[model samples]
Target: MSTNTLYGIFDDEEVLLASVKEIRANNIEIEEVFSPFAIHGLDKALGLKETRMAIMAFIYGCLGLSLGALMIYNIMIVDWPQNIGGKPNFTFYHNMPAFVPILFECTVLFAAHLMSITYLIRCGLFPGGTSDSPDERTTDDKFLMVINVDGDSSPVKEMLTKTGATEINEKEA
Candidate 1:
């Protein structure tokens, strides 16, 4: 199905945020918003759902901890036992103290790396990916708001112009 979109480019993030709130209040469906930097409270203004990246990070950390514990147990207790510093490696429990540092480090490493990967994938920003931004200025200083125009776009365009949009454009998708 063909879709028409109205794009409002603002010079400042504050103006974009206020425009988003006003547009949503007018029941206009916003396709997306593009900004050079994170605008504080813009997510709430856009009514976006809370992110679950933290929960995923926690799960990845747990997996890393388990893997680290298993590796340590297999190396020290099952495969080739070591008796470093006169401490016995008969079981994981006996050699647990020595592995604590590795466990913590692995957990943090997995959480950070995996979360970064997940964020990239979620944002469709992998290697050799093309940008989907409608305006190049959005990558520098301008803020852009995209509104889907299901019906007439004059009211939406008028509202955007009234909301301090520096430039407004219409396109079909």
Candidate 2:
């Protein structure tokens, strides 16, 4: 199925932000916005919900900590039961101080690596993936706001123009 989409190109981030608020205020649904760099408060203005990356990271870190502790306990206490420098290794709890470095390293490693992979997958940025951006200039110095037009696009076009869009383009997708 083919759909009509309108692209509003803005030269300034402030203008784009204001335009998004104005367009949403008028009950126009915006599809997406592309910008050269991150704009603070743009997510809130675009009505996006808060991200849960921090929560995911915490979960991942806990998984790593548990695995690290298990590995250390099995190796130092259960398996070999090593006694080095007069330090007690018969119980995992007794040798936990020496295992702190390994536990910390594992937690950091797992959280960082898993979070990176999660971010890439969430963003559809797998290897050999094509860019979803409508305009290449949006990666440079331009900000593009995309709107899906259902019926008449004239009203949306007029609204874009009124909201200080430098240029407007349309495409069928």
Candidate 3:
């Protein structure tokens, strides 16, 4: 990864996308793109497909909801019976509104707690973790494009220059 070269930097996403388009039009290899914030249509512009993260989240949420329902029902009805205020201990429908709070709370609790874990696992992100990031300055003020030179440095540089890059540099990787 250290051998990766930085072709240029742009202050705007439009400029970056245009440059990417031109490079791809000429069949050049783009190793990766670095951005501080997400740019609209950027993945599509780069010909990348959507991630399955949301699908995973939905599945995990459903699992949480099922687990919560099972636990609540089993505790309230099967595990132990506690009668209070002359209310039926086993029948939940008599106090629908009160039980609603428990059910709703369970749904939210399951969704939030499990979805976070799912997101972390799916994205490979962990708490207080550090890894390869583009640059501190790039995150705030610039977009960086990395490409493989493939031993044709002159033409590759010329091609990138044509895309209106503000700066260009050749990197080892």
- All models: lDDT? 0.90, 0.92, 0.74
Q: Write candidate 2's Cα lDDT for 1-173 as tens digits.
A: 35689999999999999999999999999999999999999999999999888888889999999999999888888888867998987778877898999999999988988988888888889889999998999999999999999777889999999999999999876
lDDT of 1 by residue, 1-173 (tens): 55689889999887888889988998888989999999999998889998999999999999999998988888889999977888867878877887899999999999999999999999889789998999999999999999888767788899999999989999977
Ranking by lDDT: 2, 1, 3
**Number of the top candidate by TM-score?**
2
RMSD of 1: 1.4
What would the TM-scores of all predictions be? 0.95, 0.96, 0.81
Off by over 4 Å in 3: 1-4, 86-88, 91-97
Give the worst 10-residue stretch by lDDT in candidate 2: 74-83
C-alpha lDDT of candidate 3 relative to the true structure: 0.74
In candidate 2 the C-alpha lDDT for residue 160 amounts to 99
Ranking by TM-score: 2, 1, 3
Better of 2 and 3 by TM-score: 2
